[model samples]
Target chain A: MPGQRQSQPLLALRGVSKRFSAVQALVDIELEIRAGEVVALVGDNAAGKSTLVKVISGVGPPDKGVIEWQGAPVQIRRPQDARLLGIATVYQDLAMCENLDVVANLFLGREIHRFGVLDEVEMERRTRELLHTLSIRIPDVRMPLAGLSGGQRQVVAIIRSFLGSPRLLLLDEPTASLGIQQTNQLLDLIEELRDQGLGVLLISHNMSDIKAVADRVAVLRLGRNNGLFDVNTTSQEQIISSITGAADHAVAHRPHPEEVWP
Target chain B: MTNPLPTKARVAEYAGGVRRRVREGGLGPAPVLLALAVTWVVFQSLNDKFLSPRNLSVLSVDIVGTGMVAVGIVFVLLIGEIDLSVGSLAGLAGAVFAALHVNVGMTEWLAVVVAVVCGTAIGALHGFLFAKFGVPAFVVTLAGLLTWSGLMIYLLGPDSSISFSEDGLVASLTSRYYSAPGFTYGLAALCTAAYLLVSLRDRARRAGAGMPCRARSGIWVRTGLLAAVAFTTVAVLGHFEGLPLALLIFLGFIVASDLLLRRTPYGRQVLALGGGVEAARRAGVDVTRVRVSVFMIAGTLAAVGGLFVASRFTSASQVSGSGMLLINAVAAAVIGGTSLFGGRGSTWSALLGVLIIQSIASGMALLGVETAVQFMITGGVLITAVIFDSLARRTAASRVRT
Candidate 1:
């Protein structure tokens, strides 16, 4: 069963289209991610990066689409459904309870219990172990999330997704506020997860981050897929053209940057 | 990860933490404790009869009935919500109990049970509207405040009041006292022993896990201090009528609620949900269930408290749970160290908060002050408590940052 499960792509989307009233947020999107691969989804601002993420993460359902999980069609109508299908989402906002301690936040929804009581000792131990394995430097697990730096808070949020050991991870702007050193650390963790056979969908704007660990790059422009490239073979300029909808065959072509940014 | 501190360094670290706490005005209940002490000293000096055992005993019992309502408020406030309906809820509970038992000729115990259930249901309704419908808790409960008060008035008929039998079960709950003073001292001793036991067990667990914990000597010192405080309280209250049942009930409620908050998963979830609803929802917590359940608990406890007050007076009237009851309960929770913004407070705050408010009220009354002056003084103290809470939170945030 494990071997058979490993043979299929972890997640696949076919002809997915989502419309918000008059706006076509996502149109006829087709994407796939296999185990042991990092797929970077990049696009310009307002290119529907967030909308696509929400659809996949079950924050909102696509109006028209077929979502396949491990070679079987599945419907993700809510966040809980996505979780049950072994898909974990680390949202852009991080969705953290700042007042709770690190251990509490990490085990917020699924608390360990002994004799019908919160097993703080066990939770704290597990928290310490996970942080140590990730080599995340948090001063104290007992410290509230409010006190942690931006990078540390992001690390905790990502680790929360890791707790479920999902087959697929959806990270939306996980490194947005992080510094260079923190971003590097996060890239290393993503690489590690990929090596452990976790399929990661990294939604990022930073080209450097996409190049650092992504195995493949999928570019979105104006609610449509512009291009897909092998990171090993594609040049940075090629991906940029795809993202900017300047590629000759790209959908929803825009005027050159001089006409837009100027 | 960093290695665990050695014995000597761990002890020094513990000492440094304590010193920092003192410098930071001892976060949590320390400020309130100090304020209470100061208030007691001033009142003692101002009135010769203030410190007398008889007067002290009365003051202790008087705080308990209100203490019950304040305990529920602590739960609400801890989650960063307010229940304006608690006063009306309590009044309605008392009125319901009286109407059911007196007017309807039902069994007293059965009526009390039904009254408490009514409180729970009403509270759940308020919680449902707020949590499920996304109505503002303040608005929902504010409407409840008016609605329940009106219901209480209507329940009591034309007179809007009903008296209980003097020797009834509920009446004896507050008015009675232990036969001997030794029981009071023994209870204090038992509590001290329990504290010592829990601390020792926790220390051992930390040691076994190779986690840093308080020094052995520090734990002993804390235990000794707790014992001293317990014995002193017993000595003071034991002089008059041993221990009042009301105060004992209040203390028990505080301890049980403290256990629920600290030791249970539900309590942690309440704090978590209060801290961030979205985060909790993502984590698989039934946010609506937790919110609604907390409101129900608040309502039921507030009603229970009202019953205590009614029992003390042996009557339920339109004015029984009205007037300053709501403000005093909330003020007590805040003064005791519960944060108005939520996600940081303890059940013990209710006990401390009620004591502080009642002390001032009792003291002012002893001084022959007018009700207006009492209101102003209470208001001033509540404002002071909020200021202190804000300062302490800032200090804690800064400390955590470093």
Candidate 2:
């Protein structure tokens, strides 16, 4: 009861860094996301947004730094390790097989088997229920993922993450290809998930989307953390400048006068 | 401008839907089925003997050898990979079985088991190199195709062939037949009963789970059709030998493998891997294990096919599984509806594909057609199958976009 009363951030990253061969993909990144909050990670191209995500999701571990779950240091060396810690990721590409039907894609590796046989009926039932709960409408659950629209596929991918009842969901550019209506639907779903007490880390280039649902915005530039700002008070111009490294350039002028002239 | 009657409107809608599906290349196996029917009619007209019970029975038995191998190929093809070594492995299997049984003096059954196991091990070896070492499957299996052929030759030695005993189980597998009409008819009835029962059970389960179930009338119609086909086939076979043991074994394998692909978790994993390897891996599928195990299954089945081939000929010859065996098996799998591109096929495709291939060969032979012509015809059909597959996939993609 005492431990429960001592609330800690759901996930915390302290001084995490990663390098791929000659590229410094991520450097000294610090981020914290608490329960019932949406943390939007915004960055420009080649700004190591995905690299930082991969580090946290354990697709690739950080070369240096600590990842804390419930304020305790934990090593996430693989995707399974992240998954075991209730960290679910929805990739930008949706990470779904086109030929497989909705039900099959929904329960790919974690298929339900009864008596060593795939329980299709049960999976389909659960898929319908999940879709209903999320207010996602699909023409047919039996239709292959190939036949679904970009928005529907993304929704299916997001729902698949929830099948594991993850405590934290990481969505990378989920609304990239979606239309305005679908984007609004996705943002609403993210808000609903936040309200349900799940920590959500949304990686996006869309500042408007970040403003729509994010509790806090973490801007990444040149593989390092630029600034973390509350979504309510942070100006759009400020967030854009931070993402474009303009804020860093301006700040460097004040920090060092000799370097400014050179 | 005017509303039609409810029944009439429904009928019109259904007809339009069917037309739309066919135009969009959503016909799936319907085109193949139509082609098969046209082929049968053309062949039957060319030679009345083509449809005779004796010839049909022989053709059915002949398909079993290649069908078994094709069934395994379906598994590999499902994962968007090819096994070029299946043909040579089949030859090696027969040679190994004969060598162990006759030359090494092992028990007959044990020899067969070991030979099959050896084939599986060879396949697993290829899978390991491909999956674990990141070797391309095409290169690995192409090398295996040559290596296994040489191994088969060495195993056969100077004799070039070995004959199984007349009463041996291996020989009986292909050569034996049940001539009793009652037994054949009873089996047909039992199969029909099983089909109806299973369909009914599925309907109940679907209904209970609040999932869509096939209409009762539709289910009955399918069951009735199956019954008719079952009885008709039995009656025809009854005119000759009631049922060839080889055909029964082949059909049994088809049913079992079909269930494995459609109803089991392993089958889903194979499809998932084939459909999208990265997605499957991210979803926690054991990619290496699935790849290795798939090759093992292909090899084991190819070995069983070798046994069937050897039994059919009553000997394991130097050229038992050479030449057209590999091409025909792969062609059969493709022609039956299994996509070369992967993630779409069934075990029944092997049966259908082999049947079409065998029927053409048998019919052409009966008409005294040249072997070269037969090859050309089979190749043409294979091309058509590929075209259909490509068209179907393109339509699916386009339809999704729309």
Query: Across all candidates, what is each one's fraction of true contacts kept?
Result: 0.51, 0.65
Off by over 4 Å in 2: A1-6, A249-262, B1-25
Model 1 agreement with the true structure over B282-338: per-residue lDDT tens digits: 766777888898899899988998898898789998766785788889999998888
Top of the candidates by TM-score: 1
- Point out the worst 10-residue segment of candidate 1 chain B by lDDT: B17-26
- List where candidate 1 sits over 4 angstroms from the true fold: A1-6, A17-24, A61-64, A75-78, A248-251, A254-262, B1-5, B9-26, B392-402
lDDT of 2 by residue, B164-197 (tens): 7878878999878888877888999999999999
Model 2 agreement with the true structure over A24-85: per-residue lDDT tens digits:
88887899988888999987778888888888887789999999999999999877788889
lDDT scores in order:
0.84, 0.85
Poorest stretch of ten by lDDT in candidate 1 chain A: A253-262
- Calculate DockQ per candidate and list them: 0.48, 0.44
Q: How high is the lDDT of residue A167 in model 1?
A: 88
